[model samples]
Target: MSTYFAILTQVGEAKLANAIALGQTLKLKKMGVGDGNGALPIPDRLQKALVHEVRRADLNQLAIDPANASQIIVEQVLPEDVGGWWLREIGIYDEAGDLCAVANCPPSYKPLMVEGSGRTQVVRVVLIVASTAAIELKIDPSVVLATRQYADDKAAGAVMAHEAKANPHPQYLSKIDGEAKIAAAIAALVDSSPETLNTLAELAEALGRDPHFATTIADALALKAPLDSPTFTGTPNAPTIPHGDNSARVVNARALAEATQGRAGVQGLSGANHGASPANKFTVSALAVTMRNPATGQAITKYATGALTADVAVVGANGRDQAAVIAGTASVHLHFIFNPATGVTALLWSASADAPTLPAGFSFFAYATTIRYQGANVI
Candidate 1:
């Protein structure tokens, strides 16, 4: 029986020491098996390569033995890989393709499918080092095969990790803490609220189970008129203002006109004042006047007398010297016209006994009702 063990080579020791000194990892890359000429060969620390390389592949895994911190376990799975050969020795290589360790295993025969007998092999090598801190335990998962024991060990480790702490997922609240918090929140709400409407279900029921209630209220309010500069349509009515209460209130136009002297009225107005003897020129006394426009029904007022000049006369085509024309013509009618838009007065005379035609834009015309007989002039 040959003693099966692996030892680090001189180059491997130097690399491991350098890695430990620099606080770096020694990356192991590949594992190679050899036949050793159909005989079990002894491993030498001075060996730079395998005796007769049979097959080489990337290591499946590298690990530090939990039971022995100073031992390294290198593993490779030959799942339906190369066969029809004898395995006598094995070697481990670093990333630079340098043999780091060598070992001899018990003589075993690997068969191919053509030989009517094929089997998968798992080769493991354990190397004893002073410390495993410098050895990197990483492998390319794409090119490696996971064994059942490896998967089971990992699953067991995950379970142990989960059981070691109260909350394995730190992002979520624990069951105990969550239950206590929820209970406290419910107690706080119930304590501050009435018994009839304390729980969440009661609040939901009070809202009639309509999620769009707030939106419905907002839409209804949007149809209403705003307080500022509100506009109304149709026969919108308000409280009528009192008889004489002058405050902020709505009143009809007719009521407002009657209350504010917006009507046709005159003060200290004379019927007609003939100018002296033959009544050649007629004048009327000054009077305050208030009247309303017939076109727009808007009231206007003024405190001024009527003026009669050549520009306002209607005697002849030139409209000058109204007394001579009035004395010479028979049945001459004098007319007083008022412009409600400008509160100005004008005069016109017609010889045929009817009132003269009112000028353009003059609506109110004042004519004397009683024809005065003064010194044969019919003044």
Candidate 2:
């Protein structure tokens, strides 16, 4: 049997018995060490405290002894704590600061670092209690120091818990899962993209590192003319409408110039009149004209050739002299004379209602309008 053993003090026994009877927990709070006056000692149930306490600290850990079901294990880590005393006695204190258990230890001299010898110490006390169910197991982590081995064990346990397949941290991704998603994302990035822009860096470089590239493009497009009804500038040229086909088609400046100055098989009737005049003669078989007589101020309809529509006949050479008419009615004669040098046409009416005389050096053609008496005014 080992001389190292712990026993409940008188006050602790009463408290434990009362806690068990009341179904309450006896919360063990701290563990203390003593020197026993520099001598090894034995524990007693009558003792309320150690012979001489050297250090006291909140309990670091509390657990039931696995090998002894009735034994409650209380532990304290004296991490860089008090020194220069002999650890010959140990004590367990409850929440009320009452000594709950006392035990004797193999005497060990703890030295300060200034003495050139120092070491961290772990102290434990095992109490054989009637019912550990009435003993508190939870501890306040803030009041106690942990051993390196304890910290490492706790860290390993936490990692294993985080890696548990059942439930994981909501914000974290597992390594295997994260790798799969990353690979899938990479595959999608280049699934149908061009080889030059397959990667993020390549795409960024292609866009020239301009943060406002899209806005710049939009602004540039705004400066361009729209396709519909675009306004052009600076002497724009276009295909012109063909001559003699007088449908509504746009004519370019070149087409206008060609028409006015004459092209092959076409007459140039321009304001300058520098081209040849047309040689086709004017012919009329019968003339029907409406006029208001200036003397009577009445509307009159005139018919020439006595309402006979006759086939045209050339009365003179080149048909440019006098027009043929019926012999007896009051008639109006007109000569349409063209001046080829000036591109102008002048109409000369006979002042006596007779055949008009053509002006000198002017090519001419003639047509006649006649007058008859109708009782009602006809327009």
Q: Against the unseen true structure, what C-alpha lDDT does each candidate score?
A: 0.71, 0.64
Model 2, span 314-340: residue lDDT tens: 233323234643233323343333344
TM-score of 2: 0.43
Model 2 CA deviation exceeding 4 Å by range = 137-140, 167-379
- Candidate 1 residue 298 Cα shift, in angstroms, is 99
Best by lDDT: 1
Tens digits of lDDT, candidate 1, 1-379: 5488788998888889899889998899899999998777888989998889899989988888889888989998877647889999999998899998999998888888888988889999998876698898547788888878899999999999999997678667778998898999989979999987987788889888778979978998988889999887777766646567788777776557546644455566664444452344455544765545544456555566654532223343113224453343345454455665675676555443333445566665444323443444545
Clashes of each: 0, 0
